[model samples]
Target: MKKAGVTPHIVHVSTAYVAGARKGVVPERSLDHDARWRTELAAARAARESVEWDSRRPAVLRRLLAEARKDHGKSGPQSTSAAAEERRKEWVENQLIEYGRLRAQSVGWPDVYTFTKALGERVAEETLIGVMPLSVVRPAIVESSLKHPYPGWIDGFKMADPLILAYGRGILPEFPGLPDGALDIIPVDIVVNATLAVAAAPPPVDEPAYYHVGSGARNPLTFRGIHESVREYFTEHPMPDGGRGQIKVPEWTFPGARRVERQLRTGEKVLSVAQKLLLSAPATKRTRHWQDDLTRQQDKVDFLRKYADLYGVYTEAEVVYTDNKLLALHRSLPADRVEDHGFDAAVVDWHHYLQEVHYPAVTATMRKATVGRRTSNSALPPLKRSANGGDVVAVFDLEGTIVASNVIETYLLARLCDLPRSGWPGELADLVRKLPRYLAAERRDRGEFLRTFMRRYAGADEAGLARIVHDRLGDALLRRSHPEAIRQVRKHRAAGHRTVLITGTVDVLVQPIAGLFDEVVASRLHVRDGRYSGFLESPPLVGEARAAWLRRYAENAGALLTESYAYGDSYSDRPLLEAVGHPIAVNPDPHLYRHARSRRWPVAQWKAYTLPVGDAFLETVP
Candidate 1:
């Protein structure tokens, strides 16, 4: 438009990655052509190699190294030891070459996504934007809009998707950034609007105009805020089917280098002793050499702090520069358009966008795209209770509460008994009888138990067992559900309460049951190729996890924590029960029952096996 007899003004949408690399107070037109970035990238590569090669290194050590490399060249020791530092640089170069080859073979792009973008920015600066009346708009991570147009219309995979997916999957259990780190995010609509306005506005003749359209300047939403908003939204809407629900955003700190340094120092001391002992043994000498190599690799990992500090400084600086540029541009824009077009950052309602628009859109999309599923009739009994005057939250315990038997022990026994079909129950009984002896002798020897059980019962196919659970045992399982428990839940809902069921059962087993309640919160099982990996797919809903889920739920529902009620039968539910105002113990195990009584919490007993309501109730609740 600008070139077609128009002003030919260009608005270059840049990334916060470049802007974040700045140090201290940066000038308005500062570009990312500094030497420090290359050094930091090299350090990061070195760190990645160390993590991949060092088998003996702790996970935390690998993470710290990775983080250090990402934030390289900011504020930390550049070199702890000269030899170690040299090794890191060499390794980084080798890795970069390897990455280049891989990129050529695969996507014809660089191995690192961030590096590719940085290169693109460099090219843009040198060729296109440099000569034109252009404005570079650097957005940190484009997330769901806070307001304007619509909320939660995210079009790209950046921090929001990865963060949410990781948290939901429990891959990221903690935040790994500085407390003050600006989480640069822009809504898609806001970005579009800003880009349009910038294009329409006249650009400065001296330099290519740059606008950092993100939360860092105009809206200034922190990492904490993003985390909290997500938590709150998920809590209220929840995953309709199953899997782990609301997760707490872990704490963050700036002194990640110090934390890593302390760990490395302690680890090196231990490895040194082990290395000496291995070298002394004649048969272990080869292993000792390998260990030495691994140690050297770890040392390289430790040396990554220099790069991390450097990058951190650059990133911080760029953010400052981008913020200043964005502010200046906002100031220069027409007052009417800034107001009418909703381009004024000061007037932007972040809370409204986040809570009202973005969250609802995200929730709806998740429900339709991912969690939508038809509930099986055998999965859960119909809801007998209607919500009444107040909102209600239902909490269900897994194991004996949902399924007729404990899943782990049953699977173990199924393998050991070699019990096929009719014989499975008998074999299970036999295993239970001998469980005490096995426990005394093996003491939680899971590997041995699984191997032995599999050897015995390997002939029975998984399909057959699933079919039995869905058909024969399913009805029995529902019948076994406590009537008193159902009644209590219904009573609360009849009083206009929002009911939720929280459990530690895997989604395959839990999703069907989720249809029984307004929402279901359960433990997640990792599945690959439609089969259970016998591992938790995400963090279990226990202790602090339960409380966190409750908090998210309250935030989403816009309800008071004090007005909520929680019910469970296990000792693990203590944290959850205490989190809400009303705590109810349902068919509590002896220990939990006693504890609940001691705390003056109400206790209710349910008849061990039977759905109190019919299918009609289920239809009514929905």
Candidate 2:
């Protein structure tokens, strides 16, 4: 209104949560009554440009990526078109969320959403207060309508709605919440009515007018009460899940975040073991097909836990929203008009609303969606290599391709030596001893480093080294497989293409990942008379050498080179990638990232790392 040079009345709809990370009585007014946003806003803007902003992002992205890698087992549309779009949307949302989370952490907000909403209020107050009539209506958590166009009307799950739905379906095993804490949920119609009332009636220009359209002050609903109501309702009516009986009501747990994290990690390990065992089982021997179901349920559990972490603050808060302005406004409304506009919270029956309206509506909406659908386990098992042709194959680089870590370095430092490579005088001595060779290798070729590192394993018994790798480095190597890389590898296998692992790392080091592939191409350390030869049996299988190996293998197997796929992580793998019809740059180093962009090749960042792509890196993308 001020921008248009007119003093129009404005009703800015905001959230009562903007009161932020606090407890006790929260009045319908700004927290910073001294108006510190005038300076704080400037500081926030500057922080975005400051070095600290750039410095903090790697850690934030790492955390987000850690969570994103987990599967929530929700089955999305199987159609190719929808699947691609869904993946894109998920990626974009995750990126934006990570950016906002980092900003929130730096600026000291509970979360990005609330922090941004608070900033919006400041914008209105700083820019429009004196020039225009502004009425800020801060509504607490809004749910389906109590009474409006329809009693159970809700467009989609919002705020606490998902938890309510999950509870009804018996999926929410436990929720983190304070039993006595006020939930402060309000109906959509009441908020809308209050907003209209404020907009229509100007409450004296330039006066501080804030209305709390919430239920805590009048008809309160605690988190415990909400859960109880949902349980009771589902027990009575049950979820309309096409005859699939609802699971029992979940037990609520109020353990702290740290406890929850520990439990989740433990659960993940157990589920992972189950999944691996299921996958390893022979196709015809297993009595039941538990792989898909187990995978799906595991994903759902992870998703629920993540949601709990995101909204845990609200569930545990003890804030009571003061709605004096809202009550006074309702009283001033014409008696006849009150019936038309449902602004009263006292009339809302929580039990009836939950059972007769909310649960049914949410279930109906969910049923329309294709997500979380269970499929029959009637399909034949995965194809064996002997049953497949050699027409197509996928060549993958091991170190940065299959896993994010360099196995050679890890093996040398952690498994080979007696002294702890990561601590004390051992680390210092190793660094000092290897400093000259490392410098020499840098001045020479990339393979020089590999050769120098391999000398550390000289005269080591091959059998003893294999045992050491299995005992120490095996699990760590398997754990670092990039989700995207794994998906791509599976995609190729599903298409009946042979999978190959090619790397410069010696066979002993790459043993953990070897079984996943049909053939492994790697440098082999030569031994004579069961003693040190300290020389490669063959040239290091990297760069042009890797490409040559692929060509020779393709020719021998009669594989269609142009129909094959390859994934690599560095510029050195350019020859291997260029040799294939389909090439992907996975977790690329700086040089390869630019080259991939220039060539319009698809790029994927499977792991978070601090690789600078020049000063414009952060600016050039969201």
Candidate 3:
């Protein structure tokens, strides 16, 4: 800035956490002693390039392929590439978050934000401290306005707000902290006042000032104080629970961060074991129900773990910053201006600010935005005039849709039942070794999963496998299939609608069932010299490939797509289901259930053996 006639000054706003892990009265001053600014800045700048380089490695791409297949497998080749990029971005972001936090912690700071704040101060001092007047105003956990503009005004949730809401809504049953530790919360208005004062009258050019705008030293509010205030506010005003009146708030126990993390880990381990055991189970209604329950449990565990890891450090910290320069600036002001424009922490009331201002701002605003709305799981009305069956077609997904068995279970049933009891353990062990890759393939590309899984039959005669498919496997499948789903297919066939069974399952397994349908589209295994080649003849009939195939088939058959019906169960079947007029979700997994809900499509649970009258629609409300 040009400073020929006017007194020029730079009032830089920084955070009080520059004090880092130092346990003492943190005075208002520069905390830059170690030379880390250059290294941290360089590392931050080159982080993405470093991550991109690593992400391209064969192993990393293999892992990213699964995620890409999940979200973009059916989207197209372009979407698949975009998915890979999106996953790469997420990988880089996660790496940066962990790297920053660990690096900051290594140097005694709590998190990356504070460590970088200190770096900013270093840059400012090196660039302008000696050349011009500079005053750095460091605020501690700046929250809603205390008394500026309005009492309870904030743009969004700040540092402490998530924790507060979590506690109020009873999502977090325990508080992780030092019960007596001072929480250095400062109102935005006070920070603003102190910043303006420093800017209006610049500090002396010779001595650069660091003003701490916080309430930790003077009005030190402890964990107990905060808990009581929050409790009082929430006890008076509990949140709504749909039609269940009010949600109950759990009384918090002061379990330190370490113990809480341990508890969460235990829960995670237990859930993991259950999930593994259920992995090989048939996709029965009971199994899917248990899986859904475990999914919700895992989600909650993840949510709590995230909050505990991110906010745990600050909540447990006992750092207290002293606002000496800020108080001195307030003292320098005339007595008449102090009331209207003062940076006074001691005069602020903790309970009043939290209960009347901050908490109200959070609860009232949040409730107003979400109270009147809920996701409708009901399906849309049927078409007014039914089209002729000759003009319409019906499409169905094989696994987790018409049948209660996935690729793994069906293949295992055929293979294990065909082999002697003695060879069962060896076959199972080999499958266990390749389970992760197979699972990834199943989510990403059904055809890939089918091809890879069928490689186990390489040495066996094609006649024997076909025998298993036509006889024992067919009987097992009949017992395992969804009756309601089969009934729907028969209904369409009887009405003269062309029924098509499209699946990534090989032709052998679907051949016995082909008699029930007018047309059957399935994956084909390449056979060389009457031995299985463990490869596919064509691209899998899945993802966007399925949509393209369906379009071609409909055009040749003169099937009216808008008058047709389609049923699917997994996210990979989304393209097929979405191509038709009537899309139904049958025994849908988590992703498909959410998609079906968002689209308000019919969702079925096909209880396999016996589906009750009123239990047609699945309740995926977790």
lDDT of 2 by residue, 241-278 (tens): 43454456766766755676677778778887886565
Whose lDDT is higher: candidate 1's or candidate 3's?
3
Lowest-sum lDDT 10-residue window in model 3: 613-622
1 against 3, candidate with superior TM-score: 3
lDDT of 2 at 231: 75
Instruction: Tell me the RMSD of model 2 versus the true structure.
Output: 15.8
Per-candidate TM vs. native? 0.38, 0.53, 0.70
lDDT per residue (tens digit) for residues 1-622 in model 1: 6556655665666665553333444444646444244555576577676745652245634554554433221111231122234545565566655655454224322224444555556566566544567676766567676545544666655445544543332333233345455555567766777777678774664477766666655466665666667666555545544333333443333345456456556765776676555433432324534543555445444433333332333223234434565566667766776654544455556667666765566555555655434321112223323233334455556554444344454344224323345665676688788677554432223223333333333344445445544644445445545665566556656656677877654444454355667778765544455554555545555544667878887777776667677767655466677777777766555445545645667665445553333331232222
- lDDT of each model, Cα atoms only? 0.52, 0.69, 0.77
Kindly indicate the candidate among 2 and 3 with the higher lDDT: 3
Query: What overall lDDT, based on C-alpha atoms, would model 2 receive against the true structure?
Result: 0.69
- By TM-score: ranked, best first: 3, 2, 1
Q: In model 1, which runs have C-alpha deviations exceeding 4 angstroms?
A: 1-7, 20-22, 32-118, 128-131, 168-171, 202-206, 232-319, 331-335, 368-622
In candidate 3, position 24 carries an lDDT of 68
- Could you give me the TM-score of model 3 versus the true structure? 0.70
lDDT of 1 at 179: 48
